[model samples]
Target chain A: MRALFAFIAGGLFGSGLFISGMTDTAKVQGWLDVFGAWDPTLAFVMGGAMIPMAIAWIIRARRDTPVLGGTFPPPAPREIDRKLIIGSVLFGAGWGLAGLCPGPSLASLSYGGIGHWVFFVAMLGGMLVAPRLSIRLDRTVPAE
Target chain B: MVMDWVWGLVGGLLIGLGGAVYLLANGRIMGASGIIGGLVDGTGRRDAVERVAFLAGVFLLPVLLYPLYTSIDTHITGNWGVLIAAGLLVGIGTRIANGCTSGHGVCGMSRLAPRGFIATVAYILAGGLGVVLFRHVLGVI
Candidate 1:
């Protein structure tokens, strides 16, 4: 049941990504190109996706357990720490550089050509090394 | 017929509905980075099946309906330096930050989580800056 949920949800997410123009590298970069020939469509995509998700949170509050039998995550800690800030900055920089994030990076794999594969492999390597790098980060800026 | 912000909204709705389903039914946040990152990093080795299954679905859907999306154009950078650097940054950043566009921008912000808002703002700001630096200044890509 959980697997079923994941598969269906994944399909929907992928379909939306393609349909919404999230998969278009030039379009994504255009959205970020505020200083140049900027595109404002991504705002709609971002804003629109939030509506259903916001409602889901409302539903989540009244419900106890999930339909497929799992515990909902506890509320995220209300801390604004170094890890999050630094990490997000880095992610944004990379996103701007590539015009692709985790979801679309994978979604475009089959047909996004060699460049997509290169990004994927590099991203995978990064994911593997993140924990070690994170440990080092913790050493420098111990969490509060 | 012109692809404009309307399609963006529709696609956004679908993405949100996807998040809604995963959140309500699976009892998970449906953050793409977290789902895949956990498995690769060993923190989520126990739930390998869940992660792999989800990925399979994410990857397969586009191809299964290839006929419909044949004109898919990603326009990804062919510059190896940019691709590697960008990919590494995204992988490391999203994992350490504990979310990405899907988790933080969509799921996290939707719930009004402070981290979500902060992360979203940070990434957007950095992404714009990245454009300035990588494209405008360096002319690397």
Candidate 2:
């Protein structure tokens, strides 16, 4: 049941990317153009996402237990440490350069979008390597 | 921009609503990263059927929607090699960050998670800088 819920959610998220013009790298790149050809579409897309999310969260918050039978999973760690900063930078860079972030990239792949596949494969590789690198570094270097 | 916004609103609402319903029915955050991660990390059945269907919706929906609106025309000017390199880097970033834009940006930020907040900010900044540095400054744009 939890898996079913997750599946539905994932689909909606991907659908959002498809409609938002986010799947188009050119559109994304246009937003980055500040001086000459700036596009504020991304901002609006974000707003569109935020408004509905706010409403849904309010309803969910009132619930004691989610349908799957447990309390809401606690948020991941909240620290704004070095790892957070570096990881974000890398993610953003990839998004900018490839014009594909995780959400849209995967969604795009469903259509056999060439770019999406490229991004998806690499993203998976990165996910696998991150923990290994962190553990290795943890053992090799003293904690600050 | 207006067109994109309309699409975004419709898309977001549908996704959010669908996600909420799923949450209400089950009890999971509809985060793509977590689902995919589970699929890849040995929890195959957890995401195999549902996630696959969800992904199919993502790709096919555009084709369905295009008829009702302006068609999306994508022209890639970058070399495949460069795009692939960037993708690999992004993959790593998503893992280190513990979620992707969908997980952190859409779902995480909605819950007001501090980590999601920071991660989203980083995502925007990095993406913005990447465009300027590579596309604009470097003439790729």
Candidate 3:
């Protein structure tokens, strides 16, 4: 039951990305291009998404466990470490360069062509290497 | 003009609805990066089936809906070097930071979490700066 709901949620999310023009890298890049012919479509998308999500969180506050019987996710992380800032900056640069984030990147895989595959593969490689790199970084820099 | 906004709103609502569904039913945040990242890192190993099911939904829905929507043009960079670099950054950055647009932008901010807000601002600002530097200044992408 939980898995089914997850599947449905994924489908809905993907459908939204497809319908919102978010699956189009050009559209995404256009929104990011503030100095150029900027498109405000993504803002509406973000706003629209926030409404129901905000409501969900409110409901969450009242409930201890979900309908399917699991503890709610823990509170959001609060620490503002170097990894957070640097990673965000790097992610943003990549987002600017390619305009493909994980959600859309996964959703568009079927029709994404060669370029999409390249990004996906490399992204996977990077994810694979990150843990090891972080371990090394941890060894170099004492725990905070 | 108005139609684009409408589409965006409708789409955004669906995305939000999806997040709500996951939260209400499974007691999990529907951040794509975290969902997929956990699977890769073995952090979400206990919930592998759920995550796989979720991803299958994400991937397969478009296949079924392909007929309804207009053909999508990704406009992803063709340059291999740029693509690889961008992919690596996105992967490492999202992993190290523990969130991305969906996790921080939508899920985090919705809950009024400070980390979410900060990460969102940082990424958006970095994205804007990157656009200015790469698109306007470097002219490479």
Candidate 3 structure quality by residue, lDDT tens digits, B1-141: 679889999989999999999999999999998888888888889999999999998899888888886656678888999889988988988887778888888898999888888888888888888888888999988
- Considering the two chains of model 2, state its CAPRI-style docking category: medium
**Could you give the candidate ranking by DockQ, starting with the highest?**
1, 3, 2
Write model 1 residue lDDT over B9-91, tens digit each, in one string.
99899899989999899888989999989988899887778778788888988787667754767888879989999999999
Q: Each prediction's TM-score against the native?
A: 0.96, 0.85, 0.96
Candidate 2 on B24-48: residue-level lDDT in tens? Answer: 6555566666656656655546447
Q: Tell me what TM-score chain B of candidate 2 gets against the true chain B.
A: 0.81
Model 1 residue A135 CA deviation (Å) reads 1.3
Query: Where does model 3 exceed 4 Å of error?
Result: A137-144
Candidate number with greatest lDDT: 1
Model 2 reaches what TM-score against the true structure? 0.85
Please give the lDDT score at residue A2 for candidate 3.
Answer: 82
CA lDDT, candidate 1, residue B54: 80
Model 1 chain B: worst 10 consecutive residues (lDDT sum): B64-73
Ten-residue region with minimum lDDT total, candidate 1 chain A: A135-144
* lDDT by residue (tens digit), candidate 2, A77-136: 666666667777887888788777766776666453566676678777776676776466
Off by over 4 Å in 2: A1-4, A110-113, A137-144, B43-53, B63-70
How close to the true structure is residue B109 of candidate 3, measured as C-alpha lDDT? 91
